[model samples]
Target: MIRWALIFLVVALIAAVLGFGGIAGAAASIAKILFYIFVISLLISVVMILINKSKR
Candidate 1:
């Protein structure tokens, strides 16, 4: 997931450099959304691990 976000960010940068405003904007937004989702999922996974360890 993080990899995907990075890929999109690179794509956005390349598109922006190539003068593709719409494509750059869309890729940037997608990257942001993916990054947020990845962070949220990582946090949830960490909390789950802690809960499980405490229950042991």
Candidate 2:
């Protein structure tokens, strides 16, 4: 997921450099969304793991 976000981000940069404003904006938005999702999931997983460990 993080990897995909990074890929999209790079693609967005490339698109912007190539003068594709629409494509760049879309890809950048997607990348930002994916990055946030990935971060949230990672945080949730860590919290779950900590909670489980505390119960043990």
Instruction: Report every candidate's CA lDDT.
Output: 0.99, 0.98
- Candidate 2 residue-wise lDDT, 5-52, digit = tens: 999999999999999999999999999999999999999999999999
What C-alpha lDDT, on a 0 to 100 scale, does residue 40 get in candidate 1? 98
lDDT, candidate 1, 2-55, per-residue tens: 999999999999999999999999999999999999999999999999999999
TM-score of each candidate structure, all chains considered together: 0.93, 0.94
Q: Model 1, which residues run further than 4 Å from truth?
A: none
Clashing pairs in 1: none
Backbone clash numbers for all candidates listed:
0, 0
